[model samples]
Target chain A: MLDFSILINNLDTYLEGFKNTVLASIIALIGSFIIGVIVAVMRIAPIKPLNWIGSAYVEFIRNIPLLIIAFFFYIGLPSIGVTLSGFVAGTIALAIYTASFIAEAIRAGIQAVPKGQMEAARSSGLTYLQAMRIIILPQAIKIVIPPIGNQFINLVKNSAILGMIAGLDLMYFGDLVSSHTFVTFPVYIFVAMFYLVLTIPLSLGVGYLEKRLARSH
Target chain B: MFKSKTSKIAGVLLLSASMLLSACGKGDKETSGTAAKNALEQIKSKDKIVIGVKYDTRLFGLKNPSTGDVEGFDIDISKELAKDLLGDAKKVEFKEVTSKTRIPMLNNGDIDAIVATMTISEERKKEVDFSDVYFDAGQSLLVKKGSAIKGLEDLKKGTKVLAVKGSTSAINIRQKAPDTTVLEFENYTEAFTALKAGQGDALTTDDSILYGMADQDSNYELVGGTFTDEPYGIAVKKGNKELVDAINSALKKMKENGKYDEIHKKWIKSH
Candidate 1:
């Protein structure tokens, strides 16, 4: 029989890989969100050095392929005494690569909030920090939601790169299964379906959050 | 700096977040029950063996789409080992691994042995033990038909030679041709594809792989004399003397019985 019992028999391995893939995405998403916020603020800062740092970060990371960045963490870091496994390298690269886009989205979002709102907050005896915390960020986040959602989707797909360094993500296990079974099409289709299984609910959740936030507004 | 306080808050948040996010998602093996222990005893006691082989390599270890079996010389070797150990070759489990994986999988106890086209080198010997060289492979270059690169001798600075990640071929290229900049892919197919894409001057790997690539695409031809002596060996964990001894004995038995030659001919002739 040409049926694929190999994939069925290898469910545990595939599931283990799925766990890693989701773990990497979760880490990358949180990492990029925090990084984007900081960079967005720095990019819009009046200080020259901070602005330069922000610009340099965006340009330097955006220019490099995510896999090269992954290699930097996985292989290059070891020379300087910092060693990371493939999964860590993949996640870190995912975080750093996605951060550039996230920061752009966030900066635009922050700027989109009416300048009058910040001015009003300042006139009311609030410090700059107080105004941003109390009035600016909440509104900026609303404008930033859609673009950030796209980056989230991208991060999930990019998580597949972990297969290169054997990060044991879903794609890595899928490769293992497909290579063994020789049912490349069905095995990969299964992997795609699994990815859909993860992303569909995530997209729905993002949509619901957007709707709820709009209703509150 | 009208919003100095705001900037400070942002800076702190960004730094903390980068640090915090970087902290999650780094680990080694997360093995559960049915996990591997002391490498030597694990295989002999388990009643069967799991040998890791390559999936993407052609002739030597390819997934035959029609048969649904990982066909090639390496698969035959793995099955022979199973027969030697457990009395039935079909009882052994096959785990598909790439060059990047075969080692970690071995170290983590995910596999009992690795019989892929793994070359024995001093650096790798530090990590695992190798059986006697089963196949004597010489380095060769695969190039598009009538391409300028004649052989390894013609390789120059910035001459991208495609190789798989974690392969000694990359290091070998560096050592043999010091000035060449090597472009590594994840596996054999990508290296060959990159070669076709003109990403490199030549694809340098074992002649077997280069020949397989050539067979797939007539535009590409295998060039270059064998420069480095890459002897393929079955890898077992270092200090797993028992498994090593068992594997070596099995090889010896198969070779003496002429079964090794028969199996080798079975898989390699088509390449």
Candidate 2:
């Protein structure tokens, strides 16, 4: 029922797409995590303006569609003389969009930490920044591991949108192969399998990490 | 708890797999049932024909956003065919189709025909029968007016060529200029937008589509005379000789009666 020759002949194309997807997802993962951390810190900081900016950023980004943000970078940025390749534009958009949700998750984790913990750190002569870095964040991250993992998984799936702007990701190449071969169902099935190959391992790793983190606590 | 979670995940995976298998079975069943009567005869008895047309292509078959009506060269051609076949121009239903979905939709009997500025190609001919060329187009380049690239020859190594995904233009560009990097977007609009944004050096597609883009924005112009001949045709299901003959006759009538020229003037003249 399924033809394997198309898959066999076009292995390189599929691999190129898979490589782009992995590269984009990894970059966006690291980029969004960093942004999420910073935004989460700002949201919890004592400075009012910083807190407002953080809150506004989260609200604005989380509320709008990721595609719009991607289009803004892909189509809107070039008008201002800031042109980026599809991969870069899509990664940046994915990072920015995902950061908002990550910020909320991190913030929730931070808030879940006992107030006494912060007071205890300050009483021990640790600066607020030091307390956040050396004390609170590590524990907050540990507590929020599952949610963050879920976000990471979502980030991988959302990366499919990169196909829209011609990022050369898996879905994009899958579309190309399917259209060229006119074997839509099987081509997509293979594409889905490739995605599962990326995501299932990540999902399992997250579950393992969650279990380990829970045991440590 | 870990065991339970693993089992749950496995259960969900199993369920989805079964669902997909069932869907494939259904698709096979649907595609197997060919109507014994010719499509033209069926359409005549039904008194309505379904045409799959592009809702995104601008001059060819774009849907008017404000009016919620599809209008363009392809739509006009479909209407004219309807008039010739059924004696009523309005006796046709329009279904939106993209390049990717048009063939599958036609094969599945979801649409009686495809009049979506589809290029007649040997590869596509194996899947569906096509009417005689209703519109003559060719592959061309759209670039910023002052760009260094003059034509297809300038599309050398490292030259970024943007084309729509699943389009023959992308394949043709690669064959014509193998060294040029081809980026395929979901549609011409996205590809054109990316060209304006400096995403690629040139946008390659049918000259008719490039004309539409050039018409929309004066800054971009068709850089090359058509590099590849792309004759557009109305497609029907493969082996539907009766339907193919009916469409070919209708097209011949349209040309003889000057209706074809009227449509060409309406959509292609300004471009």
Candidate 3:
């Protein structure tokens, strides 16, 4: 049976989980975007060492599972005396892991801009940095919007990993409710609905922004 | 391209919607089917009993890495039950179950009975049937040696106690020590690992399980001798009265014959 009673009974628990999930996702989204941009720029920058570091970071993080990264922060870090709560560790791991993929998306976006645009900007008395700041990045942002939006959506769903580490996110509370009630199916169905509540708007916002960018161009 | 992307999104939406509707439909059919044949007859017809047990808890049913076998007091009891039912000790299959998954697995008929180190509580009795207590464990704390926390009274505000999610210990600690923060993990291994890594001040669970952890690593020892009694029982699906009765009789016979004491001595007393 489609049970609404489980959801109604555990409304406060679900809401607490919802709030933590939202907080974790927002913090991670902003953190990953900023880190992603910096790493993307470093990969494309003129300096050789910076490019190596950027590639190393992206390749290392992207290759390993996000769960291991989260575990490292949760269980591995405390051995050397750096202890972080589950929420803090899970959020940091989310940001760190997602940044690699976001970096790749941005790098591809930056490269998609025609080489002639950069040359033209530089030839017109704009410095390389100025040409990049004004012409290259703006165009790259437009190109990267869809992929970055995709990453953001993935990040929101992936925040469920926090639950495994006792981060008190939506999926964690979902487990709690299901375990307490032994009503497995409905609890997760409701949890999925909560995630959709965050992601559908994100998907629509991306579509809207894509359209607006196309119009401006 | 945009049109294709929109269509893909629409396809995903449709797929998820259908999945949600079909899941409920399937669940209804499964529950209805459970009414026809009880689990005892089904197990007898199959000739092999499937048991759910923990592959992580050391003194209970831990999977030995070198031997590639689950060896513990619980596994021995399950084997004896298999022998009693099908005339062969090996006529049983073990499916690993955690604190979170055992009840669901039992109710889903994935396993006929759960012999995991599961505590019997009134809340759980509504969903499943429990046999007489096979092991009398009590909730206790595991702290690193030489720590200031020696007992439950020492767990003041700002103290963090780690427990497995979906466990009675988690609920009990939250009630008994309301001021201390409780951190729950997916399983005992992770909780113990977290404690070793200094993530929590102490880890709380059944004293039997804590004994397993301490036996594994001498650095950690049991503190706070038993705050609550955790009577572990083999769980079967609710309404499976025949299966419950069969298990209860089997346990009674084991106790009468001293097989139960032998198992306890082998796994518990030695440690």
Model 1 lDDT tens row, A29-124: 999888988998899876899999998998888888998887667666765667666688789989999999999898889889889998899999
Clashing pairs for model 1 are B145-B219
**Per-residue lDDT of model 1, residues B121-240, tens digit only:** 887788889998888888888887887788877888867677776677766786888888665667886566545545467888888777777767788888767888899999987887
Model 2, range B66-142, lDDT digits (tens) per residue?
A: 99999899999999999999999999999998776788899888899999879999999989999999998999999
In model 2, state the lDDT of residue A79. 92
Better structure of 2 and 3 per DockQ: 2
Q: What is the DockQ (computed on Cα atoms) for candidate 3?
A: 0.59
Model 1's CAPRI class is incorrect
Q: How many residue pairs clash in each candidate?
A: 1, 0, 0
lDDT value for model 3 = 0.91
Model 3 Cα shift for residue B236 (angstroms): 1.6
By DockQ rank, best first, the candidates go 2, 3, 1
lDDT of each: 0.80, 0.91, 0.91
TM-score of each model, paired residue for residue: 0.54, 0.89, 0.89
Model-by-model DockQ, in order: 0.04, 0.61, 0.59
Model 1 misplaced stretches (Cα beyond 4 Å): A1-217, B1-41
User: Over the stretch B1-271, how does candidate 3's per-residue lDDT look in tens digits?
Assistant: 9999999999999999999999989877656656777788778877889999999999899998898899888999999999887789999999999998887788777788999998899999888899999999999999999999999999999999999888998888988899998888899889999889888899999999999999999999998699898999999988877888899999999999999999999989954
Stronger candidate by TM-score (1 vs 3): 3
Distance from true location, Cα of A188 in model 2, Å? 2.5
Accuracy of chain B in candidate 2 (TM-score): 0.86
Q: Which candidate is the best by TM-score?
A: 2
Better of 2 and 3 by lDDT: 3
